[model samples]
Target: MKHNFGAGPCILPKEVFQEASQAVLDFNNTGLSILEISHRSKEFEEVVVETERLVRELLNVPQNYSVLFLQGGASQQFAMVPLNLLPEGGKAAYFDTGVWATKAAKEAKKIGQVEIVASSSDKNYNYIPKGFEIPADSAYFHYTSNNTIYGTEVFEKPTTSVPTVVDMSSDILSRVIDITDYDLIYAGAQKNMGPAGVTLVIIKDEILGRSGRSLPSILDYEPHIKAGSMYNTPPVYSIYVSMLNLRWLKAKGGISVIEQENIVKARTLYDEIERNPFFKGTAAVEDRSRMNVTFVMENSDLEAEFLALSKERNLIGIKGHRSVGGFRASIYNALSITSINALVDAMREFEEKHK
Candidate 1:
């Protein structure tokens, strides 16, 4: 069997793929593929509702928050957040740890002032920045929870009096997070949630309507909340698949249980990287991401050989991002511990052959 470790639109449970395939063939015994169903249909409406409900239940989100399935993915959220939350002449604080975080901060700058309170750019984002102060007057403190490309993650949320907004595209549902800690949390479904085309936004209802600027109807959160994420033809197939994945998550015990498995998977791979002399982890030890474990060979020349060896073993997507030339094994929530073990075994075998 092939082990997939791609970054986004990454691995999912085999059972989820099987169920999603069946739905694509025939959904709910309706004799209609999910791809053809209308978003307004009762069947599709139930999928959207259940998907949102599962999100709330899995995260233990308080009633004060509204869960929205939106279009345009998390990248759009970078802009919508500033348009809807950053008031006129207001400034927002951001932690720039990697590429995605920098992109988010840049988007916020277009709407208003953005203060990059901390950054790890000096070290090529091998670690998460710390000791940054969030401005009290800032509209919101934005941070990406996990830096996918750099393989670094902020284990603890930044403590700040200002509203906190997290772009959790890479780490959402991977572990347990206190939903009440932030004013907003948004993630692209392609990561731990589901396929591409759907973005999940969890916003505290009171935070809306505070932005003084006029937002386009599509960018505004109020209308989407009022319509229950059904405004302007939601990504029907994506939401359905998300619902199936959420069901799978619920069945495998909730986030808390899944988190333990993820911890084990990450440790197995990281331990291999640490003990194997042929490789060195890229990120700082403490800040290394549990979702994406990036590493480089001691001699860069060995990179291609190691990749070829891994491919021969049916291991794939271990290559890192292009900007950062190395290997990145993305062990998302759906990725099994067995797959990680296989990768670890492959690494050990390759090392033995070389050493």
Candidate 2:
């Protein structure tokens, strides 16, 4: 069996892919392919409506919260977020956790003032700086929910009185969360939901008009909200696949149940990493990510050998990210505990061989 550990566009439920394959050939009894189905057609509209509905139910989002499925990835929302949220000359606060957090801060900086309230970069982003003060007069406090590269997660979100926006591109639906607590949250569908080409945005309707910024039709959330995500030709196929994945999640007992499994899976792998003699974890003990576990060999030669060994064993994407040279085992929600166990067992077997 193949063990997948890729960071983004990570593993997904087997049933989801199997059902999605059927849809691609014959969608909703339309006889036409899912890809060729007109975006504005009834079959497609039904998919859009159900997908948005599933998102609301999964997130427990209130009526005050509006969901939009739009083109471009989470990177696009990095810029659109500040443009649509930050008032003129208003200062937005950001916590520098990893590459994505820095990218969001940089995009916001071009349109409004941004303050790096706190950063763990000095420690190579191995931990989240706790108890750092967020400015009282700031427009909003923003943070990346999970650091994919460094394998750190906030685990618990930071509290702020101001409007809070989270980049949940890698962590959304991994567990149950209080959706009402934040003013805005966005995630790219590729990792957890479906494929690329769609980005999911959930915003509090009350907080949007406060920015007083005129946004382009595509960038503005209002247009998409007003039309129920039908303003333009939507990513119908991607949305359909996302809908299937959401249904799979719901059928398997929703976020609460899946969260328990996620904790177990992460614990199983982390325990192995800590106990194993040859490999060592990279992140701080408290800030380890449930989504990505990054580690390296204590001996440089063993690191190369580990990569080759993993490849020979059919375990792929277990190599470290380029910026930080170490292997990252991305345990997204869809990655089964069995896959993680295989990796850990491989680590043990390799440790025995190396020693």
Candidate 3:
């Protein structure tokens, strides 16, 4: 068995992949591949509708909000949020925690003024910035809930009177969050959902039209909402797979149960990092992410050897991001605790052999 810990386009449930595979060859017994089906067909329409419904149900999204299954990844949302929410000459506040957060702030700057209320860049993003105040006058306060590159997370929503926007690309559905707290939430479906190509956006209806600029039809939220996420040819395969995954999530006792499993998985790995003398966690203890656990060997010389050991044990994608050279174990919802234990066992074996 292979243990997958890669960050994006990460592991999904076996059953979901199996179901999706069959759909690719023959979707819903229609004899047409999901890849070749028309987006306007009733069959595909049901897929889109059911996907949206699952999102609303799982997230407990408020009645006032609208869910959209968009094409572009969360990167597009960096611009879309500012385009639709940030008015001309308006200012927005950002919490710069890592690479993705900084990129989001940079994109918003092109459209309007962006104030970085707080950031952890000074320490290579090993922790989430704390005690920062969101400017009341800003259009919206944007933040990334979980920083995949840095292995840091903001567990609690910031308390701000202004509208709140979050890039939850990595952490969505891993835990339960009050969806009504944010004016807008966007996530790339690659990590915890299903696969790449589909982006999920949930917006409070009242938040739209605040930006007075005339956006292109594709960029505008109103058009997508009106068209029911079929504004153009949607990512049919990705959406269908996501729907299957969401259904699996619902069947497994929803977010509450899964959140507990995630907690246990994180604790299991973090405990090993803390107890083992050869390894040390990189992120601040208080802000460590439940989804991605990052650590480094105490002796720099042992890093390469430990990585080789991990590979020898069928532990793949344990290597960290290129920007930050260390091991990152991304234990998303579908990543079984047994895989985490296998990683832990590998680490112990390496330590005993070396010591």
Which RMSD values do the candidates have, in order?
Answer: 0.8, 1.0, 0.8
Q: Which stretch of 10 consecutive residues in model 3 shows the poorest summed lDDT? A: 318-327
Local accuracy by lDDT, each model:
0.92, 0.89, 0.93
Alpha-carbon shift of residue 60 in model 1 (angstroms): 0.3
Per-residue lDDT over 263-305 for candidate 2, one digit per residue giving the tens place of the 0 to 100 score = 9999999999889988789999999999999998788677887
Tens-digit lDDT track for model 3 on 201-310?
99999999999999999999999999999889998889999999999999999999999999999999999999999999999999999999999988978899989988
Once superposed on the true structure, which residue ranges of model 1 sit more than 4 Å away at CA? none
Quote the lDDT for 272 in model 1. 90
Model 1 lDDT per residue over 1-355, tens place: 9999999898888998999999989999999999898888888888888998999999999999999999999899999999999898889999999899999999988889999999989999999877778989999999999999999999999889999999999999989999999999999999899999999999999999998877789999999999999778888888888999999999999999999998999998999999999999999999989999999999999999989989998888999898778899999998888889889998899888988
TM-score of 2: 0.98
Q: Answer with 1 or 3, whichever has the higher lDDT.
A: 3
TM-score per prediction, in order, is 0.99, 0.98, 0.99
- What does the lDDT come to for candidate 1? 0.92
Q: Which lDDT value does model 1 have at 6?
A: 91
Q: Could you tally the backbone clashes for each prediction?
A: 0, 1, 0
